[model samples]
Target: MNKTILLNNRPNGKPQESDFKFTDSDIPVVNNGEVLLKTKYVSVDPYMRGRMSDAESYIEPFQLNKPINSGIIAEVIESKNDSFTKGDFVSGMLDWKEQQTHNGKDLLKVDADKAPLSAYLGILGMTGLTAYHGLTEIGKPKEGETIVVSGAAGAVGSTVGQIGKILGCRVIGIAGSDEKVDMLKSKYGFDAAINYKTTEDMTKAIADATPKGVDVYYDNVGGTISDAVHANINRFGRIVVCGAISLYNSTSLPTGPRIEPILIKKSVLMQGFIVNNFSDKFPEGMDQLSQWLKAGKLDFSETIVEGFDNIPNAFLDLFEGKNKGKMIVKV
Candidate 1:
């Protein structure tokens, strides 16, 4: 039997656990070129929220009453595929289920001995790749430049800031809580961090932290915090617009104070990208990230939730800013 979660309902604004349905079914028999897998760890990301809606977007929305899927770490229980054998660890796009029978070509065999299994679903996987592309390709940070990353406590943001430090940039992280601020500064080695939730006069706070002005902006939370970053941007700034999690739950199109004047004034270059946009460069990015992790120039954190029953709650908590780094569900 396999337990799976389905998208039971669509959300109007902020989602609830009621939007998901948990049920059980038989694990399918594997055919040639297919491998049967046992679910290990599943990642819950802000982009998954976009998939819940029926709107037209870069990726198709999750259909109602169907299995919800994302990046998952799994173990092969049976293999009819020549590329895989029983007991091999794998990571790929798989459903929120206890088990899966997938085409071998769709999954990548993971090196559990090289890195922790959960890492393949996070820091060494899609999340890490996102940071690499966002920083190097778009938000090009030169030495001594002040780079600001919003949502700096989350998985991708943390990685971006670390990479900024590696490139000799002064990194400033903006997170929701004081504790996350501390973690960003103390644990992640960010030059400075701001507690967006507690800070009054956000412009002044960021100004105080980056007196040189923000030369690179790795935007994650796009809303008022982004507005604050623009208020202190430097000339020829590079802005990488990644996930706009702050407005993910907005029922209507978000209207805000315009930022065009700021961009023109600073000659800022702003680009919005999905990780898939840089697929051709993935192997290169992964190799660099792996080497950094091994050399201890990089680090990661995870707020792991136990049990399949908690998956929905874990995902919902992301919008509320509950997790410190990558949020994963261990089944």
Candidate 2:
């Protein structure tokens, strides 16, 4: 039987277990030019929260009763396509199902021997590509400059901080928990880390951390945290707007301090982007990330939840900030 998870309802605010439905169906059959895939790992991300809503966005919203898809790493258990063979591993945006079949279009073969299958969903996949492109293309940190990353302990944020350090920038990270903050500095080499949850004054904390001022702000969690960052932005600063997990679940439009004055005064460059924006340069990003990973200049972390039934819970955990780095479900 193939266990599939679908969008049961459009989440009213924060998603609940009731929003996802699990059903059993016959395993899919592979036709000529198709490969049968067995789910190995599933990635649960905060950006997916936007896709759950029916609002117009960069990507289409998930249709009700249809399979909810995200980044996935799967094994080719059976293959009728010459491009793939049994035991081959592939990574792509696949459905949240135990097993499925594909016609090999857009699917990229991955090697487990080089890195674990789950790595493709995080460091070696879209997550890493997002970090690489956003920082290099928009943030553009220079040597002796200061870089601040919101959601610093997440997959993309942590990698962004590491890359900043590699490029000779002083990096500061903001995370929810003290443990995550510590990981950012000690494990990922962030120069400083602030626990936004415990800090009384975010703006002051950011100011204190970066005495030189923030040249680049890699924003992942927008809201008041972003407002605080704007308070300390430097002249000609660059802001790479990524995910906004803090406001993803809000039923009403969020109100915050306007950034127009700050942007105009500082001549700051702010841009929002998704991984696909850098699709043409994925090979370049992958090469740099892999080289850094193999050379010990870069590292990654994962919170792996075991069991196919636990996928929804694992995804829900993202809003609670319960996972460090990448959150992946091992099926």
Candidate 3:
């Protein structure tokens, strides 16, 4: 029997694990041009929050009583497609099931030896590309400039900070816990890190960390932290608005200080983008990320929850700030 997780109901505010229901089904049969996959790892990302609601967004909402899907790394157990062979590893945005039958054209066959199979769901995959395209295209960080990243301990933010360091910028990270703060400074090569959950004055904390004023702001967690960043932005600063994990669970629209004044005063350029906006450049991004990974310039790590049943709790953990990096479920 194959177990799949489905969204049982729409969340009211903060999402609970009970919102997900597990259904047991028979393994899907492969058709011509299709391959049967057994999931090895599934990515649980923050962006899925937007898909859960019926509200308008770039992506369509997930249908009720259906399986929720994200990136997953799987192995081809049976192949009807000539392009894929049994035992080949592949990655794709397929259903949230233990076994799936997917068209071969929709999957990218990944080299298990080139990088760990799990890295396909993290650094060498969507998260890394999101950081790269957002930083290079929108944020436009320059050498010797001060860059600050919010939610700096998580998947996208962690990669953003390290890539900033590689580009010769001073990077400061704001996270929730002291442990994450230490990881940012010591392991992720951030110049300074602040634990916002304990900080008395976030504005002052940010100012203290980036003494030169923030030149590039890669925003992941928004709200008060964004207010502070806008208040202290350098002249002609650039802001790449990424995920707002801070406001994802809000039932009502979140209200905060207006930012137009700072935008005008600093001549800041603020842009919001999704990773697929640069889909044409994915190969280019992946090549650079792969080279960097081989050269030890980029580090990819994960906090994996074992078993298919834990997927929903792992997804909810993103709201709780429980994940250290890319959160995945191993089945």
Candidate 4:
């Protein structure tokens, strides 16, 4: 039997374990050109919170009473296609199940020897691609500039900060906890880190860290921290608005910063991006990230919960900032 997590009810705010139900079903069989996959790991991202709501967004809402969907790393148990064989490792958008069937064309075989299978759900997957495109295409970070990233301890934010360092820019990370702040500096090599929870004045912390002013802001959590960064932006600074994890489960609308005037005065450019926009450049981005990983210039981390039944809790943790790096469920 295959176990799956089903959305039992829509969440009003922070999701509780009761809102989801675990069910057991027969393992799906593969047809021609299809592969049967046994899931190894599943990614839990902040963006999934938006999907929980029926409200309109870039992606379609998850249907009620249906198995939750996410990116998963799986090992092929059976294959009907010549391109893939039994025991092959692969990654793709798959249902939240212990085992499932997928078309071989839709699944990308993973090179386990090059990187861990979990990396496909994080550093080499959508999260890593998002950081690469958001920082380069939207933020346009330059050498000697200062770049600020929110949600700094998570998958995308950590990648953004390290890329900024590689680009010869000073990187500042904003996290929710002191432990995350410490990891940002010690593990990710962030130039500076601010624990937003302890800091009374966000604007002061950012100003003190980047005396030259922020040249780029990679916003993963849009709220007070983003407003604070906006207040200290330098001339011609660029801001990339990515996921707003801070506002995802908010019962009320998050207040915006009264810094529109600053945007004009500093000639700042702020833009939001969805990584799919750069799908054409994915190969190029992957090649570069792979090279960096091989050269030991890039690092990645994952907070893995062991069980397919734990997917909901893993996703809920993102809203509470409970993860230090990429959150993954080991199925």
Highest lDDT against the true fold, candidate: 2
Give the root-mean-square deviation of each candidate in angstroms.
Answer: 0.8, 0.7, 0.9, 1.2
Clash number by candidate, in order:
0, 0, 0, 0
Q: After superposition, how far is residue 283 of candidate 4 from its true place, in Å?
A: 0.6
lDDT of 3 by residue, 1-331 (tens): 9998888888888888778888998877788988899999999999998888889999988888999999999999999999999999999998899998988777898998888889999998999999999999999888999999999999999999999999999999999999999998888889999999999899998888888999999999888988888888999999999978889888789889988888898799999999999999999999988888899888865899998888888998888889998999998
lDDT of 1 by residue, 1-331 (tens): 6899999999999998889999989878888888889999999999989999999999999999999999999999998888889999998888898988889776888998999999998889999999999899998789989999999999999999999999999999999898999999999999999999889899999999998999999999999999999999999999899989989999999899899998898898999999999999999999999999999999999999999889999998899899988999999
- Backbone clash tally (model 3): 0
Model 1 segments more than 4 A misplaced:
none
CA lDDT of each prediction against the hidden true structure? 0.93, 0.95, 0.91, 0.89
lDDT of 4 by residue, 206-325 (tens): 999999999999999888888899989999999899988778889888667577798789898988889999999999899889898888989998898987767888888877778878
Tell me the lDDT of candidate 4. 0.89
Q: How accurate is candidate 3 locally (lDDT)?
A: 0.91
Which candidate leads the pack in TM-score?
2
For model 4 the local lDDT of residue 225 reads 83
Candidate 3: segments with Cα more than 4 A from true spot:
none
How much does candidate 4 score in TM-score? 0.97
Between the candidate structures 2 and 4, which one is better when assessed by TM-score? 2
User: What root-mean-square deviation over C-alphas does model 1 reach?
Assistant: 0.8
Candidate 4 — which residues are off by over 4 angstroms?
A: none
